[model samples]
Target: MKIAIVVKEHIETKGGLERYAVTLSRGLTARGHEVHVYANRWDVDESLIFHYVPCVKWLNLLKVITFPANARKHLAKSSFDLVYSLTPLYPVDIYRVGEGIHADVLRARFPNPLKRFLKRLTPKHRSILAIEKRLFTKGNYRAIITNSKLVKERLNQVYDVPFQDIEVIYNGYDDKLFNTNTRAYRGNLRDTYGIGDKEKVLLFASNDFKRKGLVYLLEAIAFLNRRDIRVRLMVVGKGKTAQYKRIAERLGILSQVIFAGAVTDIERY
Candidate 1:
């Protein structure tokens, strides 16, 4: 069978979603299915065919709006047994909801009612919401796949997608890189960071610190400090640390938090 995967970017070391796309393509190819990846940017992988979907990069809203339109045009020119999309593209065979509902994300990111309303009015959010509504309400895909039940429930409640149409498949890790063998590096990693044996270490890893609630984690750490608990937070991800550093300082727990910017070998930490 010939399969096409549509995503904005396909880089294994970039992030979880990108890595998933790469892994899926490789797995399908290894199983004797011809796999083609459609993306605006991607690292060269010899095993799979690549099709570039051009999109504007100057503006965020334009980037969101153009990708699906461009990707659909490219997809229409090809014949594939399955069209599996990681990003929002209409009328695919399968649509994987890697990122949760945009509406729910906005609600969480902007707790203030007025701020949330203002954010919803933005062109990017509006365009995303419109696409999501069309995709879910119109049954654009044969089936919807969500990484978590929370997202599946939200899809049902917000877009009225039938429960039977959504399947929950949890995210998987690369066993080759993440298995027990990686545990051998744990002691060295702790030593490199000067983590004492007695100190409890908490790891918070995410590319988007704001959305993932790094501030909340820092607050919890500060609270623990006040109770005379010795804890060290090792943050491992690619996100701006200046604002969060100021936050830690304000909470008087700057010394306890270690911001380890993005590293490829995350499993060792």
Candidate 2:
């Protein structure tokens, strides 16, 4: 079967979603499917075909609106058995909701009603919501794929999508690289960071620090410290460290937090 995978960017080493796109393309290709990826930008891979989806890179709103619009035009020129999209787009056979509902994210990020309202009024947010609404309500997809049950529930709550239409397929990892054998590096890693054997180390890894609740984690760590508990936070991701560093300093846990930015071998943590 010929398949088309749609995403904004397809860099394998970037975030989880990007990596998932790469892995899915490879897996499909390995199974004898003719896999083609449509993206604004992508790393070159010899195994699959690539189609450049032109996107306006100047503003967030333009970037959001143009990519899908242009992708649709490019995709229309080709015929494929399946169109699986990781991004929120229309006319897809399968839409994978890697990022949870945008409304739910706003609610979580900005709990105050006024703040949420203000955010919703922003051009990017408004565009995203509009696209998402059309996708879910108009049945743009034959089925929806979510990585978590939480996402599935939120999609149902926010968009009235039927529960049966959303399938929860959890993200997978390569067992050979991620299994217990990787624990052998634990001691060396701790030594490299000068973490004491008695100290408890909390690992937080994500490219999206704000959405992943790094601030909350730091606050929790500070609270632990106040109670005479010795804990170290090892943040391994590509997020900006300055703001989080200031936050840690304000919380008085600066010395306890270690920022190890963007590691490829995450299993070592």
Candidate 3:
């Protein structure tokens, strides 16, 4: 089968969605299917074919707005068995909604109904929400692929999408890379970071630190101060950790938590 996979940026990126696209493309290619990745920027890999989509990048929002539009136009000129979009866009045979619905994200980020309403009016939010609504409600998309059951439920709750139309395909991890055998590297890694062998280490890896509840984790550590066991948190990701560091200091766990920003080998944790 000939497949066209559409994503906004490089599949080799550190982001979860980007990594998944790379894995999916490679998996399909290994199965003897022709896979083409369509993106604005991508790491050159001999194993897969990449089609560049030209777009304006003066502003971050402009790139987001132009990528899908230009990508769609480019894909229209090419023929393929299926147009699989990783983004929320129309005229695609299959859509993998990895980010979940914009409405659901907005709802979670802004608990207040008025804030959510106002957020929807913003250009970035409005563009994403419009595309999301169109994809679920009006677009002739053959099937919707969600990364989790929670996302599938959100689709039903937000857009009234039938259960039959949604496919809950969870993300897969590399067992070869991530396994119990990594325990051998644990001591060395801890030593490198000055983490004592006696201390219990908690690993939290997410690009978006705030959304991943880093503050809550720090607070939880503070509450456990009465316990005899020593606990330390190793944060590995890209985010503004200054505020979270202040929170840790206030909680009196500043020395216990270590922010190791964005390590490439995730298995090391």
TM-score of each: 0.96, 0.95, 0.93
lDDT of each: 0.91, 0.92, 0.84
For model 3, the superposed segments whose C-alpha errors exceed 4 Å read: 226-229
What lDDT score is found at residue 181 in candidate 1?
94
Candidate 1's residue-wise lDDT over 1-269, tens digit each? 99999999999878889889999999999999999999988999899999989999999999989999999999999899999999988989899999799988887789899999999999999999999888886558899999999999999999888999999999987788878898799788889988887788999988889889999999999898889887999999999899999999999999999999998878887
Write the residue-wise lDDT of candidate 2 on 1-269 in tens digits. 99999999999878899989999999999999999999988999999999999999999999999999999999999999999999989989999999788998888778899999999999999999999999997558899999999999888888999998999999999787779998799889989999987788899999988888999999999998889887899999999799999999999999999999998788789
Model 1: weakest 10-residue lDDT segment is 132-141
Ordered by TM-score, highest first, the candidates read 1, 2, 3
Q: Judging by lDDT, tell me the better candidate of 2 and 3.
A: 2
Candidate 2, pairs of clashing residues? none
Superposed by TM-score, candidate 1 places the C-alpha of residue 123 at a distance from the truth, in angstroms, of 1.0
lDDT score, candidate 2, position 111: 80
Pairs that collide, model 3: none
Shift of residue 64 alpha carbon in model 3, Å: 2.5
Cα RMSDs of all predictions? 1.2, 1.4, 1.8
